[model samples]
Target: MNKILSILAVGMVGACSAVSAADIIGTVTYKGAAPAEKTITPILDDPTCGASYNGKAPTTHFYAVGANGEFGDVIVSLKDTTGSTGASAAPAVMDQKACLYTPTILTVQTGQKLIVKNSDPVLHNVHLNPTVAENEKANEASINAAQMPNGADLNYSFVKPEKFLKFQCDVHPWMFAWVTIVDSPYYSQTGADGKFVIKNVPPGKYTIVANHRKAGEKTQDIEVKDASVTINFTFEPK
Candidate 1:
């Protein structure tokens, strides 16, 4: 009788663990001809920021395509459903340097703290204007006034999920960035190598989405059960 009870206890434990979340790993690639890079000459230049660029116009890294057609700065997220992971405790960081926003694009979980830092020696005001529906009200979000050059860091949290939030500098017209706020913690931005991973997703069926500033959006249906799943996406000219 003792041996039978021990076996039942172990079986229950295994079943419980099997229903837990797992990781989804994938790479984003682009075939065919890559998009040409564009350079922007700072129109509203302050002597402080202009000095860093050394008089040469800065180019946009919007479409960072690699030799193997790897695409970078793409946002990847799992479709919101009944079952999803919780928000992460760690905060996401965005820095402004050399008269441009570093990382260019970023993704964070809704209600998670986002730290925006200005590493430059000039003043910059970070403004967030979210794209929302006509009927819905927008989140009037802005940083603590103009971030005085070499001033303290700015922090904020968005209660609602906004796919793409526009980040711009009130002082500098050319300075801009994009931020994606997701309800679930299963979201990531493709790195320079165009690779991303969403961990701790519950075992179930989900629609995985990939969005790029220029290439637009793509979706794929996937079923995650027990073990890790590998999926790849290709974004090309329409």
Candidate 2:
């Protein structure tokens, strides 16, 4: 009888431990009028790349603001977390379609695989330019590789954390993408609706940071206890 009671108490403790883990959810908003994006006329002028877009040209996506003020492309992450098992994490993918890189801004955990795919019919190059000194060794030495139309995917991973590591195509000077690498899995990117969620965060105090490529960053101290927490961030035009 005593053994049965002990087993039941242990099972109850495990269940409570599982329930203690919570999530962090929030939304990011822009405060001021968003800047107008300029049309990349050169993209439409090119013979090979321009054909992919038919006749219409696409403008830059510097600001993905919605009807209200919800902002997108902002990276929200927790500070001081490290030792990510990103190697086992699902791969993050970036694709080039219609002469442009989709999801111009992306975030991934350190050591996570990044697969770059060429979906366009024309040849394109993947060029990664990482500026951080600590990340130089982890980055690709050649930095530039060409990919034929419908070519095999290009795979990459970074050992260190770096923010806004740029990837560009020299063939299309206007083609660009930014990838931010975090040291842990506790990170989320705001969508077009400006909403984000970081899941399974243990009960603790942390410093959360929300960063925008053009608008800078904001940070706040938070404590996650029994239930999920909500923390919102706002940015203004610089």
Best by TM-score: 2
> What tens digits encode model 2's per-residue C-alpha lDDT throughout 110-182?
8898899999888999899888766656655436989999998898888788889999998999999999999
What are the runs in model 1 whose C-alpha is more than 4 Å off?
Answer: 1-17, 43-45, 82-88, 133-144
Any idea how many clashes model 2 has? Answer: 0
Clashing pairs in 1: none
Candidate 1 per-residue lDDT over residues 126-235, each given as its tens digit: 88776644202423434425798777888777666677688888888887888887777778788878899988878889999999988999999999886789999999
For model 1, what is the error of residue 219's alpha carbon versus the real structure, in angstroms, after optimal superposition?
0.7
What alpha-carbon RMSD in Å does predicted model 1 have with respect to the real structure?
Answer: 4.7
Assess candidate 2 and give its TM-score to the true structure: 0.90
Judging by lDDT against the true structure, name the best candidate. Answer: 2
What is the lDDT of every predicted structure here?
Answer: 0.79, 0.90
